[model samples]
Target: EPEVTQTPSHQVTQMGQEVILRCVPISNHLYFYWYRQILGQKVEFLVSFYNNEISEKSEIFDDQFSVERPDGSNFTLKIRSTKLEDSAMYFCASSYRMGGELFFGEGSRLTVL
Candidate 1:
């Protein structure tokens, strides 16, 4: 089965610093997304990308947050300024079509101090 892949499984950053999280979705998938789960909290959607543009985004995706598929394969999330509340496990996911079951990557854990 095809799966999403993420790099730098763990990251530690200071407050106000920038961090970039990376992911590679399944080869044939067209829709990609980013989600994050804070410790002891439910997972929350951040953004969804399709057709090289943002299809959906949550309130949590503020000016400090951004996503891109720079090389058309690797999907990336960049946090312009990390905050203590930004600490969470970030998951990348992909789907063959809209509203379909998503294939997720092993999460990237971010710890902000």
Candidate 2:
């Protein structure tokens, strides 16, 4: 089966720095999302994108966060100013349709100091 893939499996950065997490979702999937798990916490939704625009976003996705489909197959999340609280495993997911079964990437672990 096809899968979503994330880059820099692990990244360490300082607070206030910028971080960009990259993802390549399954070619045929139409919906993409970004979720985060803070160590021991449950996965929390951040944002969802479709048709090259944001479909929805959580409160946690503030001005500091942005999502873009820079190209046909690449989706990305950018944290303009990383915060200590932002340290978490960021997952990239894709689904064929809204509310459909999701396939997640292994995750990119972000460590903010």
Candidate 3:
């Protein structure tokens, strides 16, 4: 079965530094999303993208954060400035049907120092 893949499985960044996490979703999937989980906390939705535009975003997607699909296949999430609170396991998910099941990546762990 196809699955989402993320690069740089683990990343460490200094506070105030910028970081970008990359992912490639399953070829047949349409809906794409970014979600994060702080250690020992619930997974929180960050943003959803479809048809080359942002479909929905949560409060956590502040001005300092952005997402883009530079090429049709790869989706990237960039954080303008890293903060201690931003350290978490970020997951990339995709689904063939909107509002349907989402297949998630192993996770990209971010550590802000």
TM-score per model over all chains: 0.97, 0.96, 0.97
**What would the per-residue lDDT of candidate 3 be over residues 1-113, giving only the tens digit for each residue?**
78899988999999999999999999888899999999999999999999988999999999989999998899999999999999999999999997789999999999999
Model 2 misplaced stretches (Cα beyond 4 Å):
none
Each candidate: what lDDT? Answer: 0.96, 0.96, 0.95
| Best-to-worst ranking by lDDT | 2, 1, 3
For every candidate, C-alpha RMSD to the true structure in Å: 0.8, 0.8, 0.8
* Superposed Cα RMSD, model 2: 0.8
How high is the lDDT of residue 106 in model 2?
Answer: 96
lDDT of 1 at 103: 95
How close to the true structure is residue 110 of candidate 3, measured as C-alpha lDDT? 99
- What's model 3's lDDT at 65? 92
